[model samples]
Target: MSMPPPNRTKSAHRSPALRPVGPNSLMADLDLPPPTNPHVQPVLDPIFDEPDDHGGPVDPVVLAAAMSNLNMLQKQRSNPHSASSSPVDSGPSSPNFQNGIPLAPPMSSGNSSSVPGTPHFGAQTELLKALDESTKVIRQNSKAPTRAPSVSGIGAVVEKPDYSEAKIVVAMVGLPARGKSYLSNKLMRYLRWLEYNVEVFNVGQLRRTKARHEQEAGKGKADHSAKFFSHSDPKANAAREQLAEESLEMLITWLKAEGGNVGIMDATNTTIERRDKIRQRVARDPNLQLLFLESVCTDPAVIAANVALKVQSGDPDYAGMSREEAERDFLSRIAQYERVYQSIEEPGISFCRIFNVGQRVFMNLIQGYLQSRIAFYLMNLHLKPRSIYLSRHGESIYNVEGKIGGDSDLSERGWQYARALPNLIKDNIGDGPLEVWTSTLQRTMQTGSFLPFEKKTWKSLDELDAGVCDGMTYEEIEEKYPEDFISRDEDKFNYRYRGGESYRDVVVRLEPVIMELERQENILIIGHQAILRCLYAYFLALPQDQLPYIKIPLHTLIKITPMAYGCDEKRYPLPIQAVDTHRPKPLRQRKNTLENTPILSAEPDELVFQSTTARDYFGHLPPLSVGTEQVQEDVSADTKLPTGGMIKTHGLGLAVEPGALKEALERGQETGELTPRAIAER
Candidate 1:
């Protein structure tokens, strides 16, 4: 995710062409209503297919309808000269174009509507033409490539263009525990996960480090409470001002460094003067874009939750203190900042205010790709600590058939897992107003159906688009499109399926889901493998290369509880039969007979722990209610292997000895030190 090379054109501030039109202006004359025909719904469904668990091909009738709609839009462009001509052209140089500025033609005389009573075809066509024009304008303004390379066939793997010269400094603004730290860390992690070179310059961390150094030198303990943050207190104000200056100096230096793309300044940049100081300093760099992100929360419950989490999981100042004392100290810190806290309303400054997390969002002057991306990501975040349960939908009929992508119904074993899911959730999460989220697929919905929790679906949560190979198995893909299969194996992350999505595309679309998840409390996401992979990679902070390869097997429930340092993850396997659809590409399989493939040696119903902490699986962990005591009982009960089906961990291949595996499982259940959360928080 590198920036595009610097543009020689006028800077963003001076360029009127770069000025974005208001949303109303863009949508003013373009509103295409949905198709009223019931027949169109099925066809439209295929356009947004998920994984094999929830995707199918477009019917020919729907394809014909789409083609007809496209033809209608093309009708107005049939006469290119007419489209180029001014709508009100009485002469070659009419008043509409007197100064060479073209104006939109007047609507057909006295016709109140752009389209007549036949709204479907006419209205859609006009709207499409208008949208096309707008798209062209936007593309012209953006100097970078307007689109990815042509992926007409299933095999073309296009290289994503970079944005080389773009630099951004996202300054955090809000009172203590208003989600500033969480938002900053989350944003930084997300961007870095996208392979962007991003770093956070936390002013609080700087101030704390400085204070610690002074204390080590026998100086008095630093008062890092809210009092030190007040703008009215001269001495405290001077200390804060000095700390901010030092942090900004470091940020600017990093921005000018070789690989820095974005530097997030994390602090309570509350007052107008403080924010302006940041804006003015960064304003000197014509190439650098400064964006102020304000996390404003008023809800008492949300605030209290944030404060509690801060006391328990955040704030180094709270160390060695009791929860009561910590909470009081943190509350006092918030009160001090509230005294001088001024909401960001500086005229002409590029800023975004996120109200109570995702409840509402407002932005001004936020332009460019990087800035807009940051703003979009922030709109999806809520600072509250919560648990997100992620699981791949139960095995589909296609899994038994060895297909890659299709909207197939669940297999018998899949239904078994689905039925067992509720018990698993109950045992692990205890009680909560759990919300179920699934891709708009029948299989995922079916997998989550037995759960009494309210369910919502997201189109973006669907699996990676296999395009022309939607219903085909990996074997079929190799036979039909060997080059594409090989290309996908070579660089799976960047390999975009012909007219389908790459892992990168999946990541981009999943940004909203991630943001929404950040705001949610207790959510169980029942989605496809690829979608789950993206979500899992985000919370656990896996590298980009590992994302596409991270195996998300069926019948497993993954719980992620985000904390201050890193998240705590637990994988619980339901006691149900399911097929192993995971196809790991081994080095030996490349350009040779696909023989001697590693076999799954684990049990069909038993959980396979990765190289991650054994405690992450069996021991007591935060956010997850399950403990080693229960895990020991379950492990002892299910030690027997089921028939001949093997459960193989991919990377370990045949290296895992049966005796060693049993020994590790037994050892994991033994009593250990305090919970992983305690160790991590410490």
Candidate 2:
């Protein structure tokens, strides 16, 4: 299975210095036995004579073949020199030569008599000697018999020239709707045009085939609706897993047979586990090159539109849902996505993000494949950025509800966002090893469900706990515990709900998660609103007070580039119409179990410090007397506390406009606020 190293010799495209030599020209130069009995006349054809076709010189192929034949004759048989002690003057003795017409002389004779200065030789012997000398010079200047060059290279020696059987397998992965299929198709066509044998296996089709097979085998039975839509069913999950494994197996079979040069597997291989399986399968073949392509779309609206279109088109591979059904399907898929993202493990998988802009991205991928040596050269020179990208799951059902945190699945708009993500990535990111990370939450998972990257889920990335307030409306909380609500308003930062967690708690809980992130390279984290905020704040170096207030709007992707000094942040907001689902369900309605699901509690040690003192982290002044009641102040004189605590409370300046601040404060009240005692407790 091992392949020989590639030829490293330089190309020999330039013309040689000497004049063109024909096939027979080299034979003229070789010292062949001359005509023995004077019956044959020496041939006088010019070595540089042109061929009859187009008056051009002899073809290189023909000349090369002729030279090879001559070499074989020289090596396999005895020449005239082996049998004769004295060389005969085998030159043709025609009467025309006797006329004193000075022509090129015959080749040299071994006997001394034929040479000059021999005592027995007559006066005419001088002419014979001169002819012999001239013939010797002609023999020395002739071409040497050798093999013909198969390839065009100067001084390029191919140790193992046979590459006719080499094979490569490439896996094209990306978010769904990111054009994995499109890119796969384009690559197949291009490779075919290049005369390489290519076979493409689309996983979606395989799954359908497997589903039908299972039904026919009577191995399992299920209602059509259940078979098509159920996400939690064990049978469905098993069927899906089996489908993926079988598809890969089939691809391997194709590679072993007529795979020729390249084989591609196009699938929603969004989990590292799947990628690892492929890697393991291909690892047995040393000649096989495993390439990963990840397609991403940064624009949420575009993704949503594409998702809608796919649904409308009724593509068999894609889940063909009506507009309403598509939205529901998107939600269910998001839940599955969350599960996959949470399950990602170590060593990591490498993939390239291909934006679905069109053929440009596909062409770039192909170029990378064909010119990998050049790319490696550039990479060694540090010409490109080593990047890792993370995106939040597209907007989910709970996200639209203005709820702090929940596992509610992504809505229709969310599906659109997911669909567009691939194209955005393709258009913007080019290509390379890319891995995706998401929390084990429905919303985050759904957002990434469409992507084609190897996805891993970290349970640690789950949303912040709302505790006993999990499914409660804001009004319900205010009515049930008015005093507690007021106290929370007084101190939002350190205010932990009776059963839920404080922002500080979230920070402490995420410590291990952050450490893992540091160890990874080029990871994209798709998580919840609050969880993302906490992580984003940590990267941006925002103070504790601002962490909870960070505005992570639905359908917006925030990119944090962590650097030596700090992290750079950029936001790509989806332009889809916001579905206003923020209003809490009526109190009389029974809350959905999925929304009220409880998560594992943090380890006791994860709590870290029981209390943290507020240290004017946001640079805000102390409260000022308002009508002698000493109401909490918004902005007053900048103050300096002991222990290097400086509070530049100039009302948040330009970065935090007055209107934004007011809005933030209103949101803070809706959630909870930090009182003086709470700050001291934190």
Candidate 3:
């Protein structure tokens, strides 16, 4: 039996756009009145068509009524300019253009309500329109050339252009080797996973390329040395400024002309002169936003580690130089940068200062959803090198029977695999601090039962929900839902099971889980095939189209170690035999389901891990509980900051000491990401 890709945890809060709205939810706390149809719950069960493990849901007469309304919303979003769904637009020159949406038109002057007796009828219409505007429907195949535009009043799959998504310029303002590139890559990976278009323009890479070009043309040598970055050297300083300007210009052009959502300037914008130039370029466009990230490390240990890594890698600055010479030269280069380094201090500019790789974080003037997201992710990051072990549960009864999804107990062979897991982990990880996580299902929990480690459960780790076909074999599904089976084969990633989830939904549900994993050090997860696949994809930086197809064989442990710029993996497949659960892509013979599958009102999976440690529970690792720590907030005027975050507010955030970040360049190792409370404090 093979598990699926890895999924994420349920640690972080949902983005506002993804959160459910209406009076029955978190939105209701805003003092909203009940809807006219009070019986319609805010979080309605989607029209899944099939029943879950239990029999069909208790249906109301209008159970399907909401589908039409949802479809209307989907339609409106797809074709915003449709006569049936025209926005209140006065054109680009309108005063409300800054909002990226036109102002709502005034209600009909003479009538108090659209319906005579219903005084709030007009307001309801407006609310419905707003909901319609906010909602979007995504189907990768919706715009297939074979399909014609909907002439029967259905939606043409599309999303309205949201110009309000602020064009953001993220400028890194730290000294060399402070994990700026690492942070930039993490940021890009995360935002891109969430479907945001983000790009990075690295000044160092650009400068290196420029110098290499100049050398090839015999114009000059590749002048990358301590003297090259010296502030006192007018020629070198001017050349450095020129490169900075060129990178910023590239970033600006991409944002404006290429529809880039976020453009990252991955460089040491350490001086005020450099940052001000970036600021001026962004200021010209009111729609644009600038965020400066300064990584400050006071820990000498971490700096030294970072510095060792700096010269050991294939970098142009120290190319062809001996290890000792390279290290010395790089140190000199850092010293030169230190002479003119200036922290971000200009008022009204958004910026974040990450202290010791998120031991603490200081943010100021952060505005916009995108900017806040950027800050939040950084607050939970750390550079501590650690390994992530991903594996599937043992073979199950369902696996032996060629079944797809079920909460089945392990077979005898599966139990053998489970019992072997402990020694396997011990041999590979060697008594390391390992936290074991499993799905709520008995199979996953039972598989990790012998591991002597603190255990936790994540509902997101459960196997893909097979819905109405939970206990059915693939042959059974092929016979019963021929079209559905074929459709799934055609596009497994996006093929959501009726009354269940798709690989895409699994990816979405696992996002927070990924965030938590990023914050941890060593972890062993006993997950399902789909869940493991997703997790593996994230660490490997695999593309979405290939994620669902990644193999996760049973009884195999994949150890992934994250480095500065990449992740390394080592696979250990224990000697255990199990049935094959993998189903290769099937040939497309049909395009739709034969009929509707059963609709089961699903029960929420429990998210709890029962610690079933082996006999050695005597004190191996720390608990996963989050402790609260107060951070200095709204801090202004440079001053001392107390550790553990008790506040003493003046105006600005805790300022970095001069040369503190230089220590980060010299150092490299620190504590892993903080717990939830720590991120919240930031």
Candidate 4:
């Protein structure tokens, strides 16, 4: 979305004078409390808070109650959604009372209890009642005009001016082929989507077109003549500069006439001086604001590849340079361009460095960078944070089959989701480089295999272990050791599997990972459901009791950003991939007899091809056993299915429908035919 224009007039105006008070001022004495936390240093009072004749010595009892209420107010401010409402200051005129006593004065002294009699019988209670009254009076009087004379120029109240009519100019600058054009287009699209009246000016294109026309006109000039030179000569350089200046001036005039709040300048501002000239011109108008955006390639190879493709397609912008030349030019210009632009830090000009890197590395770096920038921008630019995103891998066959810890691989749909993620991330997050993190699990690995990123799988980032129940269905466990099943539910967080782990154990193990994450910049974590919940809880400041119960749905991304006081979060639910939704049956579920179904067969609709030879590549498939009934299926050739379900084919192995397997296990449980111990052993 387009930002509102800056008001240059506001910058020229002097900042309003603020009153300063000593540490022992009456206001501090009556309202401020001593800092308790070692991390919390005492802060100087804000550049406000003037003394008034209404202020006097505060009543000790009333002051105590006020201090308590202030602490409550601060806490509420920290968490805006808190249920408790802050008490208002009434200046001792409130009608409410805790008992029969009147509310204490705003500047009351001496504890009401110290008097020790009926007048102060319930001193604490009376103090609260009086404080409430005082607060209400203060609130009422705040709306009334003061009858007292103004305190001359020293106490003059300066009204804050409005800036609804300000103008903002945003400039995009980068090397020739670093995706600046793509980013500008994306921004324009966003602005249009937000219904903003925007105008885009491409200085480079204008200069090039003008130069081409000039060259055509000067073609008659002698090639060896000293009086007339080619377009690349000093004369041509002067002409281009003149054209650039004229173009910018005309563009500004048009923008002013149109009266649009947003103006975009798309140019390769290789030098700070060039950018500053634009800023200075914009600053001449009191309502104009300026923003500078810098784009850089963290991976030069990507840019070189892109440049080559663009050159092949006859892109006019890069017509002057061959692919190799363009790549070299970009590489040469990046460092100097970045340094010059970054050095020009001023109030109206905002410099954002866009790093084009692999998604995994980008996510980690971005998280950390975003954290620092959010804090910096909020304090410096007076803007709030936006766009926190989070996501997890889609469901896999391992998950549906009740497997706790095997990297079996993603069912068909899972692979489809993996391929679809890049587009989803791009569409939802705009053209900015997004950071992504994934676990080292086979399921998580396969799930994120298709994402475009520099991925590093952390061993600690793996899923919770189910131990002996790694591949067993729930019914198998219930039939075997009912007591263990019951105990697990009773203490889900603390319940350790016979040989696996507990949720609490996972939390403890994730401590280092969490610490590293905290230190990172902007990043999206592609993780498992249970593990994600713990990380989510840590950021949300949720209690330990709530950690195990946090629900993390599949195919959804979550983003969380830390603010000055707490964290802000958002979620983007990815559309389910068609393939993921309609996965073919696993080998253990089909009903065909071993002799009838070929082990290796190609199905038209499925992306997977079964090869009898390849089956050995992934290692032997686990044997299928129905309760105590052992079914020996001869594996001959590979057989493929368009959709996976409960079906068996001769020559091919059994394709176990996930539902059928669960039902069989349930029936076996009722008959006491299958036991958890037996399932674990198998």
Q: Which should have the higher lDDT, number 2 or number 3?
A: 3
Report the Cα lDDT for residue 447, model 1: 74
TM-score of each: 0.59, 0.30, 0.64, 0.30
Per-model lDDT: 0.58, 0.43, 0.58, 0.43
Off by over 4 Å in 4: 1-389, 577-682
**Residues 1-682, model 4: lDDT tens digits:** 1111112332233111111111222243478775342322333323211223422212222222332343343242223211111122322245632232213211122332111111111122433344334323322322222224432111111111112243556676665556555455444433332234565666655544544444556533222221111222444334434544655675677568876655667766544345656777877885565666555553433444333333334434345665455434433343323332321222223444455511211100111111222212211111122333455666778666765566666655565565566667677667664444567665665555444543445556677777777777667877876876766645455566655666655664564455335434455667776788777766554434345555566676666755322345566667774223222333332332123212234463222211111011111212212111121232112211111221112101112232443455445446643333222111
Clash totals, every prediction: 12, 54, 41, 81
Put down candidate 1 lDDT per residue, 1-682, tens digits, no spaces.
2112222222222222122222221232468453342211211111212113211221222222322443353353232212111123323375633343223222233332111111211124432233233223332333223244563236554454344566888898877766777677778888876667887888766666666556666666866665665544555665666667678878888878765888888888765556667887898988887888888766654555556556655456766788667766777676566555555544456667677765656555555546655655665555455788989888889988988877877776776676678778888768766777777666786676556555555676778888888999888988987877888888777777765777877776665466456656788989998888888878876666556656677899998877654677778887777777765545543343222221122543222223232111111111322211222222221222212212111210122233443343234324321223433332
* Candidate 1 colliding pairs, count: 12
lDDT of 3 by residue, 323-430 (tens): 668867887886666555545544445677777887766555455445655665676577766789998988888889998888887777776676677778889768
- What does candidate 3 score on TM? 0.64
* Candidate 2 segments whose C-alpha is farther than 4 A from its true place: 1-390, 401-404, 579-682
Candidate 2 accuracy as lDDT: 0.43
